[model samples]
Each structure stands twice: as structure tokens, then as C-alpha cells.
Target: IQAFATLFQYGTFDRFPNLKFVVLESQAGWLGYLLDRMDAVFKGPMGATTDMKELPSTYFRRQCWISADPDERALANIIDYVGADRFFWASDYPHPDHTGDYIEALAELVAPLPSDTRHKILCGNVAGVYGLG
Candidate 1:
């Protein structure tokens, strides 16, 4: 994740505002803390080392996406923190840890979310990430 921080701090998002950075296989529970930490570090004394046009977290909000596995029950809180638009539901299929029935897993994870947020995480977000939007 430091690589992501380095890229954001170094102005990669600023350089290509339309570029989308996706973090796959990594659940998003820690992203809130990481983004907050980046914001603080960049705004602190170390700010001089970076030439970002916006707060580090702002760049992330504008250009990053994270994939959440179906079994991660904590994603609800992450959704609240990161916004539903930033997440994509991934089955992580073919991996040993993935569920054998992806559809069932997806249904279970999405059951508690509101319709709009559920749609975003399961469909719209992935479409937009892949330029299908």
C-alpha cells in the first residue's frame, strides 16, 4: 500500500487526473486509516517533499478503486467511509480462498446494503473502472 501512497504523494494522480488505480484482492477495511494518515503526513512538515495539487486523499477519492471479497462482513463500514462508488465486488474466483458459489456469496454480502449502494459496488463501479461506463 506504500506504493500507492508514494504514487499519490508524487503527483501521479495530478499528472493524469483521469487515470484509475485499482487495488485488487486487498479488502478495503484499512483504506480509511491509510487515507487519513496520508492526508495528515502530507499536510504536516513533510508537505514540502510533495507537490500535489490537492490533499493526498482527494486524489484517491477521484481516481482509485478497491475490490472487496464477498465474505468481508466489515465492508459495510468501509462503504460508509470510502463511499459506495469506490468499491467493486470481487469473487476472487479460482483462488483457494474464494467461494465455490460466487453468486451466493455476492447475494449474501449485498443483502444488507441499500439498492443504490448495492448496485454501485456490484455493477456500476466495475463498469466505470473498466471504461464500460
Candidate 2:
């Protein structure tokens, strides 16, 4: 969260308009609260004078993507709050704590979502972000 906060507070996004920031290995559950807090502070008295082309959350929505572990139970809520397009499903392959079978982990985590959202998280969003298509 502090990493993201620094990016916004220091005008990193403004400095590099085309850069795409990816937050990996960190779980996605904390993102919603962090974004909310940033926006709240930016709108509050101390931050009302913040000089930026857009709100902190606006910069995030435009410039950032985050990876969530395949088994993270809060993924759906994170997607709903932070926008589905911001997430990439991470298999954490080759790590000791990673799932034994990536496909099974992905299926279990994505099964409850609508088909389109499932497709985006499982394939489309990452592909689009990385230009894999």
C-alpha cells in the first residue's frame, strides 16, 4: 500500500504517463481500502491543494494493475471495488507456497464469477495489459 501511496503522492504517474505499474505478490484485499483512503485524504483539507491532473484513484485506474493469488478469497470483492480490469490472476508458479496445479486453482477461484469477468481475470485482462494478444 505504501508503494502505491508513494506513486500517487510523488506524482509518479504524472511524470510517466505511459508507464504501467504492476503490483505483484501482494494480495489484492488491501487495494480497495488503500484507494478509498487516498481519495479521502486527497479530498480532505490537507490534500485539497494537491496539484495533479487527476485524483489519486483516477491515476491508479489509468496506470496500475495488481496481481492476486489464485486462492485469495477476497478477489471478487476486490474486483468489484477496484474495477475488474485492474486485476491479474497470479498462479505464483515455482514458489513453495504456490498451488500444486495452476489450472485447478484458477478454476476454483474464478468459478463463482460471471463468465465474462471470469474470462477477463483468467485470460483477457492480463493479455490486454501485457499486449499478449
Candidate 3:
């Protein structure tokens, strides 16, 4: 959260708009709150503290992506609100702490989402983030 906030606060994205910032191996449920807080700060009196020309969330939606843990169920509910194109699935495959079969869990978690949102989270977003065709 700190790094995410700081980058926006420092106008990092403003200077390098095309840079892709991917939050990996991290649960994505906190993005909504962070976006809200950052936007609030940007619009508040402290807004002048940063040289940015856009809201923090605006930069986020344009230049950032979050890797959602396959088991994070709450995230599915907020994907559309947070921008379905801003997310991608990450299983942390082969990591010892991430043991057990999570494919079924991933499938069930994403099953409730709309088809396009599900497709973006599962495949399209990653390609978009990395500039793949």
C-alpha cells in the first residue's frame, strides 16, 4: 500500500505514463480502499503537495495492474467496480507456502463474475499489461 501510494504521491506515473506497474503475489481486495483514500488526499487541502495532474486512481486505472490471488473470494465482488481490466490472476505456483491445488478454487471464485470480466482477469488483462497481442 505504501509503495502504491507513494508512487502516485510522487507523480511517478505522471512522468512515465506508459510504465506498467504490476502488483504481484499480493491480494487485490485492498485496491478499492487505497484508490478511495488516495483520491481523497488528492482532492483535499493536501492536494497541492503533489505535482500530479490527475487523480491517483486515474493514474492507477491507466498504468497499473494487480495480481489477484486465486483464493481471494472478496475480490471477485469488486472486480467490476475496480475495473475488470485492472486485474489478473496469480497462483504463486510452485511456492511452498502456496501449496495444494487451487485451480478448482480459482474456477469457482471466478465463475460468479461476468464472462468478459472473468476473461480479463484470467487472461486478457495480463496480456494488456505486458503489451502482448
Candidate 4:
């Protein structure tokens, strides 16, 4: 959260517009709260914090991606809060903690989302972010 706040406070994204950031292992459920608070602060007393061309949420949506554990119950909700195109599934495989089939869990979690959203979360988002074709 601090890293994202600092980057936004310093206009990092505005300076290096094409730089992409992928946040790994950070369960994506809290982004909505963080962004909401950040925006409130940005619009309040500390509005002069930076010469940011846009709000923190705007930069995040444009230049960042976050990975969600396949078994996260809030995944679909998180994907909705933070654009579906900004998320991808992650499995803490071989980590001695995760269990079961990651693919199966992911498939089930994304079943109710639209096809395009599911596709992006499954693969398209990551590929596009990294120029992976």
C-alpha cells in the first residue's frame, strides 16, 4: 500500500507511463478500500501532495496488475472492484501450504463472470501487460 501510495504521490506512473507493475501474493480483496481512502485523501487536505495527472486509482488501473489466489472466495468481487483486466489467477503451488487443483478452483471461481472477464483473468491480462502476445 505504501509503495503504491508513494508512486502515486511522486507521479511515478506519470513519469514512466509504460512501466507495468505486477503485485504478487497480495490478495486483491483490499484494493477497493485502499483506493477509496486514497482518493478521499487526495481530494481532501492533502490534495497538494503531488502534481499527479490523475488519481491513484486511475494510475493503478492503467499501470498495475494484481494476482489473486485461485481459492480466494472474494476473487470475483475483487475482480469487479478492480477491473477484471487488471487481475490474473495465482497459485501458491509447491509452497507447502496450498492444496487441491489450482486450475479447477480457478475455473469454478470465474464461472459466473463474463467470458471476456474470465479470459482476461485467466490469461489475456497478464499477456497484454507483459507484451507476451
Cα deviation in Å at residue 30, candidate 4?
1.1
Q: What does candidate 3's lDDT look like per residue over 8-44, in tens digits? A: 8888998997799999877888888889888998899
- RMSD, each candidate, Å? 1.3, 1.6, 1.3, 1.4
The runs of at least 3 residues in candidate 3 whose Cα sits more than 4 Å from the true structure, single-residue gaps closed, are none
Clashing pairs in 1: none
Cα lDDT for residue 101, model 4? 83
Candidate number with the higher lDDT (1 or 2):
1
What is the per-residue lDDT of model 2 for residues 53-95, given as tens digits with 9 covering 90 to 100?
A: 5778899889999888977988888888878888888888888
Instruction: Please give the lDDT score at residue 26 for candidate 4.
Output: 73
State TM-scores per candidate: 0.92, 0.90, 0.93, 0.91
Error of 2 at 68 (Å): 1.0
In terms of TM-score, the best-performing candidate is 3
Clashes of each: 0, 0, 0, 0
Q: Please provide the root mean square deviation of candidate 2 (C-alpha atoms, Å).
A: 1.6
